[model samples]
Target: MQGRVIYQEHIDVLIAGGGVGGAAAAAALSQLGLRILIIEPGPAQGRRLAGELIHPPGIDGLCRLGLLSDRSMPGSPVKGFAIFPADKDDPASSVTLRYGEKPGTRHLGRAIEHRILKDHLLETVQRFPGVTAWIGARVTRIEENPDGSFTAMVRSNDGEEIRIRPRLFLGADGPMSRVRKLIGISHETRRYSGMMGIEVEDTHLPNNGYGNIFLNSAGVAYAYAIGGGRARVMFEVLKGADSKESIKTHLGLFPPLFRLDIERVLATSKPLAAANFCIVPNASVRGNAALVGDARGCCHPLTASGITAAVKDALILRDALSESNLDIATALRRYSRRCGRLELTRRTLAEELREAFLAQTPEALLLRECIFSYWRTSDKACVRSMALLSTVDTSIFSLATQYGTVALQAFRLLPRWFFEKTVVDWHRGVLRLVHKSLAFQYAAIRQWLY
Candidate 1:
């Protein structure tokens, strides 16, 4: 197809997606006297409902970005998370996790829609003098120009088309980013298969302040308290059958041990259904185009750090752009530098956790159980684990190293099997870290885009 923009527009920065990352980027850039244009493809038909668990920093990011300015919306202020690990049936079931009432943490999921947050961000963009927001527009092709700029060809629902040329392009587009692919940036797409999440609420949970995970032979369920006498129940359904039907057929299968949460879930499952997912984990940026949120990399939604990670990407990129020489390429390079040096180790850790958890092997289940036990017992370990999820520090590796050492030490206090299992998981984790570290170094030294 010949690339032609039916209408032409100019913007200092063209952001391809207006979710958390793109919206935050536009808001930040708008403050700097830049004309910003945002293109967001609205929710797809039968859109995936985000059973996303938001952290404190995510809530902060929304307020900071002006997306959740309404303090009264019970739907937007999460103060904590409650997690149940392993089979809730085992009165002594291990691998149950919780994160509330911690020293520095506050609030959990605000029971809000990601779409609402995205729309609010677009609204924030409109407040900027030179910002223009376009919903229902999907950028299909991107033409990278030789003058350090690019043109994106986007199509709207009404079949109208437009071309946007911007000095800088930010592809907050998403996990399946067309611009990132057009820029020749490939992602190691990891299908987080064999898992499903269902939203159900009936009564106040064990503790809404913390997120819960149920690690059983069937699969893992990460229960997040969504506030207001409700929580979202996410678990693995039987693989390869119609998952929703499977959930419906098996709704009464929750073991006798978790009768409270189970009964409530069964009581309130009237509007609940299963949402399947996939995630990207390889690269976060490419030349002028960058990815964030589920866009850059999505690990197990069990982590539920989507909002935090996306918002943080925009924040650091904002800083990277500000501190650098203002050269678009250089600034983007710095941004990539910041992300990799800043996030790779922890990201690798998360990826390793996924690999270990996917198979539901005895070792994986045991270790998951042990991790839940450790985190619940130690405040420091809780903080360390929480920090890794937040990805707020550049030295997450150091923090993880210290915590892993501690974890290993504590694990040694247990059976030898647990230690060996952790070590095995690290084999994959460390290799990923090394690979990402090298990738970042190469990008820094060579500036190779293609």
Candidate 2:
């Protein structure tokens, strides 16, 4: 491939996979006057973008990158999250947690079309004379030199092969990243189930300016307003559920409180697109190469932290590389240590939520009741949970405390759970419930302690 390279160049940083993380990395790194080359397979303009919502930390990250301005790109401002917990009897029960309700932090989130956001970041990078963006390009090979530089072979849209050598190589190519594999990094992925996402026009949420999540035994439903009379709805369907069902069939899985908003959106929306909800638990770095975004790791859409994590990765990587006297090994090590810690917190939080609500076992449902009850009755729990979910505080300590509280609450409810289960399964259900709670607590404690 090197011999076949018709063109060759040197870049300060060579990034593969020019999606949210890659594009943002280019934009941020260009500020340091470093030559950056981004090889992306997508068109110059993004076609379809998932993960449209940006939590507060992500918003702050984009602001730091200079992609978010006062006027900002076209989008809606989200204040907080409204969660509708699962109740087989009364699904309408709900609780709203305002982001602003927490002290020392402004309560604000942002929602924008994923495509529009990507284009803005790309355009920002292109404006920098030091950055070169190759749309419709794919990385074919990467070779690490003895001097800690990387030689990457990229093929353009026109079938032109070009080789690039850079002091550092960043892989922001997303979940199925070729760079991650080429650099010999392995990730464990679990695809829990599938979700149906629909984009509706002229649709408004009942809780406007907030991300709405409706949890049920069937699955989870999410609704948030994007800008310009539009909103995005995602439904995590139960196993064996039909994907081709009408919009109403899918949206109906939500509670009655959400039915009107769901129907309004469905009436004006197109057919929903089904996708899998997956998480990659370990997306750490290796050698001179590092992964970011879905490439680094992905979480359940239930958490809605993908966009925020990606933007934060971009910032972390850019800052790490910009440090003085930093060798490639030192820079990547710093990124791994910092980003890995945050990734663990994000992963643990999503796991706790999914196991409590979406798992759908009798024991899981019991756990959900205890967890949601805590959220509804305890203001401190509500604030801390929302803070962790929003990435405002990506610390394991915060995550551990929230789950720890939930575990203790579950213990207090164990007697009631035992009474209810003994009639049905003669203590089997009660034991399962206990096991579920203990497993979560053990994992969380181990993560915190070590």
Candidate 3:
């Protein structure tokens, strides 16, 4: 399957995938006066159902890279998140966590449609003096040179083969990254659930300017405006659950105010679906090649941190390279080490939140209650939780502290359950909770020290 190379070129960096991460990387690295080439297998205008929501830190990163601005950005401003607990009878009980309410945090996030955001980033990067982007082109083969440089064989949409040699290679292709595989970096993927998304027009959220999350026994539903009066509603479809039935059940869980609008959209348009999975890679950097965005790793979308993490990855990579004086090896090592810790915290928080929100076990249910109670009663708790959720703070120590606090609060409520259950059953649940808490603390400590 050796294809004749029709064109050959060299660049300082070759980035595979022209989506959010790749585009941002090119934009950031271009400032270093490095020649960059980006190859995207998808269309110039992508219509994929992917991460659209960006946390504040993500917005900050894009702004820092000059990829986003108030005049140029195309998206709705999200003040924060409003969460509706499962089976709640009253909408007033929903808790609203607003950004900037916590001191020293950014004021808002953004929720642009995935396609629009990707196009904007790609276009922005292409205008840079040293950045070139190829639409409908992909890297088909990669070979390492004796000097640790890379030669990649790219195939354009029309079958034109191009050869590129670059000092550094970045894989921002995605979770199922061919670059990662070709580079011999193995990863483990765990399917958590599935998501179905439908766009409804001319509808308004109950808490306007805030992302709304509805939690139910079936799973979680997210509703928010994407921009220009269009709202996106996404529902989680647990494994083995019928997609049609899950959509219906989740729609019913929404407030009556906009359920009709969602139903109308659902009837007229086909939904977009994506798998919810977590991927942990054995390594994010190998030789002269490195992985960013989901190519490095991904977590469950329950925390809505995909785009946020992707943007952060680019900024971190930029800083590493700049700090290491453009030494690819040293820069990559630094990026890998720092991002490794952040990924650990991101994945751990997402997993914990998923279980607390969806798991039906006694311990999870109690933990959920404690979480809600903590948010409602303590302003500082909400601030801390939102900081972690927004990736403004990725400290393992803070995570452990937050979890320990909630576990203690849960323990305080165990006395009420003592009378409702047999002593043995109640004791068993408490023991399980304690064990889990202790295990998490130990892991956090170990990760912190290492």
Best by lDDT: 3
Task: Estimate the TM-score of every prediction.
Answer: 0.77, 0.87, 0.94
Runs in model 3 lying further than 4 Å from the true structure: 1-9, 44-46, 101-105, 147-149, 422-426
Residue 171 displacement (Å), model 1: 1.0
How would you encode candidate 2's per-residue C-alpha lDDT over 311-352 as one tens digit per residue? 888888777876744466877887887887788788778877
The candidate that wins on TM-score is: 3
RMSD of each: 5.7, 3.4, 2.2
Which stretches in model 1 have alpha-carbon errors above 4 Å? 1-9, 43-47, 73-81, 87-89, 92-111, 194-198, 227-230, 238-283, 355-366, 393-396, 399-403, 406-450
How does residue 271 of candidate 1 score in lDDT? 39
**Candidates sorted by lDDT, best first:** 3, 2, 1
lDDT of each: 0.59, 0.73, 0.84
Residue lDDT tens for model 1, 115-198:
454555676667777778777888888777685456788887676766767767888876677777887777676444454444
Winner on TM-score (1 vs 2): 2
Model 1 lDDT at residue 6: 34
Error of 1 at 194 (Å): 5.6
